[model samples]
Target: MLGRVLEEIEVNVLASQAWELYRTLQLAKFIGEELPNVIEKIDVIQGDGGVGTILNIIFPPGTPGFSSYKEKFTKVDDKKRVKETEVVEGGYLDFGFSLFRVRLEIIEKGEESCITGSTIEYEVKEDAAAATNANASSMVSIQPLVMIMEAASNYLMNLKNNKNKM
Candidate 1:
């Protein structure tokens, strides 16, 4: 598999109903003037035939990308443990700065809640020879992705919960 391709995606559980928190964590790695480079911003735009979506993650110095994917917003079954949404985001950031294909899913226990569960699958199926930044990804490091998923899901659930309250 060396030279051909090695695909890896890690999954984990995030705090219940917390998307903004996850977003903050996602950007933390790119801040503080440390590491090989930095990440400035991430603009995630996702929407497609109720299945397709777009996510634009921007980096420092003006490197940005637009990713599109098909998503299924539902549960694993009828008696779903949670509500969920999944999207695949893939693209390049400044040639060698970044290149990856990621599948992200967020889940919540209820209809309108902040967040509860999440998963992130990222892999550089094809990294250029010049690209040196290895994909140091794990279900641990990508806790933020999961965290956001939980939050988003919970947010939806909470919205429903609030309506019931009203």
Candidate 2:
């Protein structure tokens, strides 16, 4: 059976800012720089941070049930603040999934807040559906990403606040 999952998190940040961060690869760069404990590094394997861009994400040591993975951008819409990426190598490919794709969208709630929505779609190999389903279920829990986004939002807001104070 094909497995599909979708999740979303609301953030106290602007949609334009979130879209810029996703489209320009600044989000990955920021996480790699500020949250080494969560993500060790992010390397661009190809493309220019747009559709068809390939990225290698390395998880920090001791990160449970995860390591490095390669993902290719399938779609990126700046106007809509949406991005779709597929795990072409590593990650769940080792878990019997024949296909794995993730879509992220940032929807504006107001001038200062937005929603980060993520959709996960995958297909499991025959005879391995059960195990793959279990694994995919765990992967669908995107708490790490939410945490990273929250940290980044707070950092940027604080920076802006400090500048205003100055």
Candidate 3:
């Protein structure tokens, strides 16, 4: 079975400003610091923040049946303000999912505003028994992505507001 989920949030900042953070490893660091409950830690396994970079993302302990996953940056396009990462080890793959990928895009809305869109694509092993296949499909959710988007939006908005006060 194949599945996908998408979520987007408008950020009160220039697309370039948002891209500056999204296109680098700083986003992972921000998540670790700002949303430790969602992600406990992120270790760079290889490469820089660009394409081919690999990250070991560890979920907080006690996160039902999930511990960590290794994901590789398959695509990072600064010109288009888009980035993509694929889970190459563990993670949803351990839950009978054959593939899991995430894509994030920043779309300009106005001179000082933009939208951050996140997408998750996954495929379950077809040969898996019916029960496993069913369980894998149920595991796909956009809630986590939604939380990230919300946090990013709030962070960016606060940043812009603070600058305006200066």
Best by TM-score: 3
RMSD of each candidate relative to the true structure: 10.0, 2.5, 1.3
TM-score of 2: 0.83
| C-alpha TM-scores of all predictions | 0.35, 0.83, 0.95
lDDT of each: 0.35, 0.79, 0.89
lDDT per residue for candidate 1 within 60-132, as digits (tens), equals 5543333222333323222233333433333333223232333322345354332233343333334532254
Q: Which stretches of candidate 2 lie over 4 Å from their true place?
A: 130-136
Q: Is candidate 1 or 3 superior in TM-score?
A: 3
Residues 122-145, model 3: lDDT tens digits: 988876637553667567787878
Candidate 1: how many backbone clashes?
26
- Please, what's the RMSD in Å of model 1? 10.0
Give the C-alpha lDDT of model 1: 0.35
How well is each residue in 42-110 modelled by candidate 2, as lDDT tens digits? 999998888899999999988876698899999988878888999989887877778888787889999
By the lDDT metric, which is better: model 1 or model 2?
Answer: 2
